[model samples]
Target: MPSADRGVFSLIIINKAGGLIYQREFQAGLRKLSTNDYLVLAGTFHGVHAITRSITPRIPNSQPPPSPATSSPGTAPAVSGYSYPNPGVAVTGIDYLETDKFRLTCFQTLTGTKFLLFTDPMTGNVDTIVQKIYELYADFVMKNPFYQTEMPVRCEAFDRHLGAWLRGRT
Candidate 1:
């Protein structure tokens, strides 16, 4: 991938409750916000997610989506469709990057773990990169016994691997 295709602007990890658990910016030129403000945003999003799940309609004994048909029955339920109860955070929506210099991509795991990835707006294959990051988090952070849920994700291995991977890709 080209350097421009792999550059990341920042990342944020939010808890199920929408509390900002972790955040870091790699590139420059984005407007800065106070640490307190970032925390508030996370908490607000968490509330929105809870509201969404509660409002999401329950599907009773319904057939899975077409994409799930290719997978085994054991995994078919995992591929079930989702309906957004609210407009924004409830559905993993992407908030616009400030100044148009970057793009913000949000990924919400089925367990309500959220990863916010910031990248160059024009970058390609960002979803792959984000998936790798999520994999790293599951391996290095979530698996660590020392990591407490809803706390800041401060695993040194995660940072090292993420930086090294991004550097290698760029």
Candidate 2:
């Protein structure tokens, strides 16, 4: 990707518990919604993400493990290279939701904070944009002394730097 696209629509940040920490629109187009509506949207989307992850198919183990009796007396027998993957905390939610008009790209951090970037559907280099946004989030938001975990992000430095960086990229 040579550069970040100029068609950025908006961004929304959600805490681990699915609370909206930040929300902003970069360009016009998306319909404006009431405050309660935005909160409901965040919560509903969080539920959908969880439901999708829960339905992931699991492959069954072909052969059962040997009986403990067949193994050494002190050690218990265990299956090799076979274990069920945890659905919860195992898979990241939907990476993106695309429509003809725009695309919603989601980037989730290790701490369970999620950054949702909305952009034009044809935009390329979106992953790069999201990554940079996340970096800015870490540096300006997470590292700030005043910032509180799982609380709304109200850092002026973060807002200023994020806008500047994204503006420069575009």
Task: Give Cα distance to truth, residue 53, candidate 1, Å.
Answer: 7.6
lDDT score of residue 17 within candidate 2: 94
- In model 2, where do residues sit more than 4 Å from their true spots? 1-6, 61-64, 67-77, 80-90
* Per-model TM against the reference: 0.67, 0.82
1-170 per-residue lDDT for model 1 (tens digits): 46654488788899876778888877666789899988887777667656654555644434646665566776535644553444354444443334466677767888777887878777878789889999989999999999998788889998888888877886
Task: Tell me each candidate's RMSD, in Å, in order.
Answer: 9.1, 3.8
Q: Quote the lDDT for 67 in model 1.
A: 65
lDDT leader: 2
Estimate the TM-score for candidate 1: 0.67
